[model samples]
Target: MARTLKTQVCIIGSGPSGLLLSQLLANAGIDTVVIDRKDRAHIEGRIRAGVLEQGTVTALEEAGAADRLHREGLPHDGFELAFDGDRHRIDLKALTGKTVTVYGQTEMTKDLFDKRHADGQIFFFDASDVSPRDLTTAKPRVAFTHGGESIIVECDYIAGCDGFHGVSRRAIPADVLRTFERVYPFGWLGILVERPPVSHELIYANHARGFALASMRSATRSRYYVQCDLKDDIADWSDDRFWEELATRLGADAAANLQTGPSFEKSIAPLRSFVAEPMRYGALFLAGDAAHIVPPTGAKGLNLAAADIRILSRALIAHYADGNDHHIDTYSETVLRRVWKVERFSWQLSTLMHQFPENSPFEKRMQRAEFDYLSGSETASRALAENYVGLPLD
Candidate 1:
């Protein structure tokens, strides 16, 4: 016979988004169980986004998950844009009256994981062959394997934070779900080096050859990325070649002070904008990457995930505690309103920063004109500030 468990909420995956959602639901006095396939070590080892917008930080703090991030994270008032060999700075604090913090996703995940693990609010490393069914019925259940035996968990609600490749997205019925996506011709080849960053603020460099960004994870560990063909081989670019290309695109001003160490990790991420409608299809709710995704150029992935769960947590509380489904019923529409706006903003940022060999002269001129307006015009800068900092979440 299989073991049976029951909870008010069941959350899948243990990334920053899943773990944070779990903590918030737990703090709300809901009986929640979080399950992940990977162990603690592997979950914390993966490197991801490092920038957190002001609204996201505030959301985490309100939910009691921002203590460590507030303490250890480095706050930046602005970042820079390098174009035509000149650097232009966008002062986020001055323009928006808020600051964006630099704290790697790993650190945030580890903090939330540790807290949940200690309190025994999460049941991880016991997930395998998980599947959810009959979400429209009164009784919703997730079946999986644990300790070589079948396990079944029944919950009043389910949170699918399983990310882009996870099984949650596939479970949605094709006819009912509508998906919109735009795949880019190029992708980003990212690397993390064991040396101090050359600049104090992030530099978004737009060179004739390609696009490059100089960002940091810590005082000693720096993160960098360059645009590359969709199918470029990681092995083809040797260490020397990597440095040479990076220097060519982002090293004009700091030729002498720039020093790079051995690369600890490398990855290639394709740029795309994706959205799946009706985040809730009855008892099961989609959150984070399971719901929508934007290009990383705008640094909106994690922040958007955090925002999604804020709405989710509130709706769940209202439904279970007060028997009010008003918020729950409107969850999908409310979140997607912001989703489309972000999709537009992210697409604009990507088009402005990247070099498209296929673009016509008129298109190129329009991009340059838009960049110039954003760099010099105060009204234009404030509009950028509003989107970059984030829109208000109800």
Candidate 2:
């Protein structure tokens, strides 16, 4: 026999987007239930993107998740872009009046998970799956199983925060969906080293060979990535080989203070961008990667997801409190305005940094020339700064 429950909102996935949205709704006295297919330990242990834009920090602080982040994270003024043995620094404060903070997604997830766990307010059903049903009807449902028993949840509204591989996006009818996509020829091979960072600030390197990024998750944990052919084999990249490649691409003339440690985590992230219009269909609304995915080149994946939830949380609240569907009806249109901008920015960053296959000599020259222009031109650097620190949330 299946059990049934009720809430004002049903959120699938306990990621940053879902958990944060749940927190916001719960703060407003709205009942929300969040569920994820992964267990608490599994979710917290995964190594993902680490950079947090200034706007993301602000949002997290407002939502009370910044307590742990502030204590452990470092604030970075800007990043160094190196090409052909020449380096040019873009000062984020001078260019955009904002700076990005270095904080890993794992830490953020742990903070949000622990905060909710402490309050005992937001219900996160980890190691669970919630399925959507009857979206076109007045009463929608999320069915799942927990502890060997099936459970069904009824909600007035459903938030599809589950991400690209989630059920929420699939629940939306195909006829009502409009999608835009861009796939890249390369992927990022990343590793989390146990040693300290090689540099004080993050470094983005564009060598004739490929692109590399030097980043940090904590004072003791450094993160790094190098562009690779989409089909490169992880089997071919042993620990020694990985460090050698990284040093070659990112190592500078000056001693980089770099050290190699056993990489606790290693993985490849395929580059792609996607968005689905009208983020809502009937009582269901989409937020975060469930609706869009940006290439990791710009570090916008997690931050954009957070921004989507921030906007959707307000819309969901208005619908329940005042019965005003204005925001809900226009949700997709509203978010896409910012979404397309990020898409462009991510694409630009990817092209400027990565060495695409099948490029002609002229195209290669154009890429290097673009790099030169960005290095020397105030407008280009400022544009990168604004997008990197993040655009406005409202």
Candidate 3:
């Protein structure tokens, strides 16, 4: 049997982007129905970026889902960048008058989920074969199967908040969609453990060996990463090995306060910068990873996604509240302008911090020289801080 439902907006994907969009729209008296291929538990359990730009925090606050975030998130005024056995602090607050919140994406999604659940927002979980149809028509529809029943959701607009591998982006015509990408030569091996972080704020380190980052979920729960070969297997990286490599890369000052323990979660993620052109096709708007992706070096993944939703929610709200399509008409252009800038920062930081495979001595010297410049010049350091704190959502 087939069933049909109607809403002003149909959001595909139940991640933070989709959830935040739905929440914001609902607050404006607009109704939305959310759907995802994965169930709620699966989405909530995935480990992801924890750094939240000030803009992201504001977006959550707008959605009224920052209660727990404000209560539990760590506020970092600055983070350390290391090279040649020394750490230089980029005081984000001093340089940009802003700070980033250290709240796990997993937890953010949970907060959004809780609010959506309380609001009685409709969601289809474990939805299979989800497809967006009639995007060019006045009415856009999403068809999917859930709980062994075929369902269709008809709406004025469709939001593809689904990630890179999701179906929403695929809904666009192949020839019409152009993509840009840069796949790095190495991957990051990250581990989450039940222990205090090596530093209260995040530390990004570059060493002769590789790159390492000491980050945290909270004051008590730590997350660490080290650059590694893409071919390396998780089974090969024992806790002792990971800790030893991390210490070597972070240097003695940070290592003095190191705490090592058995990691409950471990995984390796390949580094890449990807962006899909024209975030909108007909009436379907793509936001978050559905539109772009950045490397983890700049900690822009989740924050970038939230940035997308912020613009998107505002545009959608305008369309209904005042019948303004200017924002919607230029959503892709406006968002991409910000997206490319962030991508450049993430790529630059990744190139500066990581030990490239078969990197020449000259390249290494260049990296050292650049770090020295940043360490010496407040202008250079401030530039990095400005991007780290995040650019305005203009």
Measured by lDDT, the strongest candidate is: 3
Query: Of the pair 2 and 3, which is ahead by lDDT?
Result: 3
Find the 10 residues in a row with the least total lDDT in model 1: 251-260
For 151-241, candidate 1 gives per-residue lDDT tens digits of 8889998899988887777788998889999998899889999998888788887777788888899888899898899899998877777
Q: Name model 3 segments beyond 4 Å from true.
A: none
TM-score of 3: 0.99
* RMSD (CA, angstroms), candidate 3: 0.8
What is the lDDT of every predicted structure here? 0.84, 0.84, 0.93
Error of 2 at 189 (Å): 1.3
TM-score of 1: 0.96
Which is the winner by lDDT between candidate 1 and candidate 2? 2
Indicate whether candidate 1 or candidate 3 has the larger TM-score.
3
Write one digit per residue (lDDT tens) for candidate 2, span 242-283.
887788887565126778889988888898999888788888
Rank ordering of all candidates by TM-score, starting from the highest: 3, 1, 2
Which candidate has the highest TM-score of all?
Answer: 3
Segments in model 2 whose C-alpha atoms lie over 4 Å from true places: 122-129
Every model's TM-score = 0.96, 0.95, 0.99
Clashes of each: 0, 0, 0
Write down the lDDT that model 2 would get: 0.84
lDDT of 3 at 240: 99
